[model samples]
Target: MKRRFLPVAVAITASTALLLTGCGSSGGDDDSLGKAKGTGGGGEDASAPASPSPKPAGIKRPEVKLPKSFQVEFAGWTNSDPKLQAIMDDGKERLLASYAAIIKGDPQHSALAYYSEGDALRTGTAWVKGFSDRDLTLIGKGRVYQPQPRISPDGSGTLFYCVDEGKGSTKDTKTGKVTATPAGDAFVLYRTKLRKTDEGVWKTTMVQTERRACK
Candidate 1:
């Protein structure tokens, strides 16, 4: 998904420092998604539990949680090949980690660092910061579907997916006012680069997004 800024009354001088539109991008680091830096502080929510589903062996997974106000749905996440499936799983987790950071108002969330790195990390950090800077948080639901995973002989990987933000919106962290996003701004396509670490973690290294690329 590409970066989509909140529709708040406040004017954003930088277009790249924003939140996920329907699609996810590499935050706002690249021209496609725009750029910004993330800020704030917090830790994993103790009430939330780690995903109960089995993950690839030897991979250290972080516990990701979203508040009751926010929800994300993933479609078609399975793959016949274990390696490719691992990529899909990690890719999903990375996106979740990003949202988790934003919701907790913490740009330095450990899960974000655990799931992403390099340009992807910088972009995500900026995106999360954009919200924290404005005292904004997300509410409602977003959907991620149609995952397409590819593996390179050199060992790097890529995952492409679609996001629907039509049902999502932003809420004021303090006043609790909610701003609705236009449906026209929903639906985005995202491409992400991944590399497996020695610890067997698939870290997102880069991300690109296209606006209105999907229905």
Candidate 2:
């Protein structure tokens, strides 16, 4: 997590962010999702039955668009399962809007509406507060690359994506001085778990983030 791209309390230290196992891979080109287990190994048990998947909830994921101000490019999402595809498609918009809201420093922004009442909401509030407290604003463009959707046997879905902030920057509010540049040895990776609400909205339940650097 680079300093310029992070919002106050949401900022992760670079040392811990760089701990990802491999730094050589671009984190792109891998569309494989988690695999399901099957019965019968070398010597299988005859009495066992395979686990059944949950029925589709018929929920519709909402559509999201990036703000014209931020030049964020997404690698796109992929999922072979129809139900899970709907879930991922909707989740991606909320995810992007979350980032956009942070960049704009607007707590009341519509993007903030996507976050539920957990870490996601807390982090979103912190981002807006950081800008207001420091009298600063973000001034840069970034990109994100995420893998296909991976749904659990119980129906929860996990999405892993990388954020490249090397091209962005931040500046002071009053002095108008360039305080921070986005480029550095660091980038960010996020792992978010989402579950549909009873109201049929796909909300993020938990988010795990790690900052990594280019080798």
Candidate 3:
């Protein structure tokens, strides 16, 4: 043989040493680079700030409202899970109050408490788009669609049951006013959704009706 193979062993060990030194140098540079940014990717710097959380752009959500009767199904969620419960809860309160407001014939004032700024803007701009304001006033004032003699929901939205007087306006009131007879009307219930805003609290949503249809 030309010589013993021990020379190969020496070469291998030398290369290993160089590789180890290079790796050590690179690792040290990485640590220093992280330190320059004051990051805690790998350091004892407790001063490293925690990651910032995202802010919500809209009102938070609240809790779910179980339908009191066969009326309305009040339920939902917001894109932001963190604040959805609160938002839904607020919405429920507003929705319940909305009926009371309408019953009192002061929907505008009720709107303040029941809807968010965004909702009010839409409700105002629509000016009864989905609603026949005149009919609403007619039936609403007649108390045919009474919200309730009184409301009794907690901070959440209200659940109200009412009897509509089916008689037309041609009948006479106790006086000559011609108030119709108190015909048996359908029993109805409703639930409102509420939310919180910068100006104050509001009902961002509303759902109402008896689960069972009017006979």
Candidate 4:
């Protein structure tokens, strides 16, 4: 997945949790899918259990104040911009498709949703590695303002955009600093590159952000 970049470094420490047969509290940081938080798990502090996965490491976080069905609506609809709008229904699904992992700051989730594959997960995370401030030059920050259906100079594929409505905040795993953050003022934006596939629907080839100067 491609993203807009801010000029900062954030250390994102995954809880290194594993979804064992037992049921834990499933906090935000707890990775219910893979490794454990402390031991043998390759995530963070293998020595002891972290309190709860706080927000992304370095970025600031906006309160969950969007309308109830935000992400779903975005994921489910294919309407054009301006004339069309994201509502409670499709908006919520859109968020679930991507932010399901975006909320956790996991690049794997982004890669799969946008690229329709897992190849880009590692690369996506690297863009935000060590991100520390709003001024940071990470992907997915500024491009949100650009129009949707963004096509390359050659006009090969389509691109889309969004604000921090669904993806949540990006954190520093090592230092716990949030890098890309959302404030409670207006809509955040992102640029997503896409293409139609044999499946007959537009597919995201890349997702990215362009950093902005907050007034």
> Which numbered prediction scores highest in lDDT against the true structure?
1
lDDT of candidate 2 at residue 137, scale 0 to 100: 61
lDDT for predicted candidate 3 compared with the true structure: 0.29
For model 3, state the Cα shift of residue 122 in Å: 4.1
The best-first sequence of candidates by TM-score reads 1, 2, 4, 3
Worst 10 residues of 1 by lDDT: 36-45
Model 3 residue 139 distance off true place after TM-score fit, in angstroms:
11
RMSD to the hidden true structure, all candidates: 9.6, 12.2, 32.0, 19.0
Give per-model TM-scores.
Answer: 0.77, 0.63, 0.27, 0.34
Ranking by lDDT: 1, 2, 4, 3
lDDT of 1: 0.69
Candidates 3 and 4 compared: the better one by lDDT is 4
Q: Candidate 3, which ten residues in sequence have the lowest lDDT sum?
A: 3-12
- Residue 99 miss distance in model 1 (angstroms): 0.6
Across 1-215, the per-residue lDDT of candidate 1 in tens digits comes to: 44446642111213333323433544433322332111111121122332434666666678887887888877556678988888988898898887788788899999999999987888778777878887888888877766778786668888877667777888887998888767766666667789999988889987766556655
Per-residue accuracy of model 4 over 1-215 as CA lDDT, tens digit each: 23444322111211111111232324442222122122221122122311221232353323332223122222222334421222211222233333334334444443234434321234344432323222222223211222234334433343333332223344444655654444432243333334444433344433333222111
Model 3, residue 176: distance off in Å is 14
Name model 4 segments beyond 4 Å from true: 1-95, 104-147, 150-155, 164-188, 213-215
List model 2 lDDT by residue over 139-208, tens digit each.
5566555444566666666666555566655556678865444345336655666677676555766555
Q: Worst lDDT window (10 residues) for model 4?
A: 11-20
Best candidate, TM-score-wise? Answer: 1
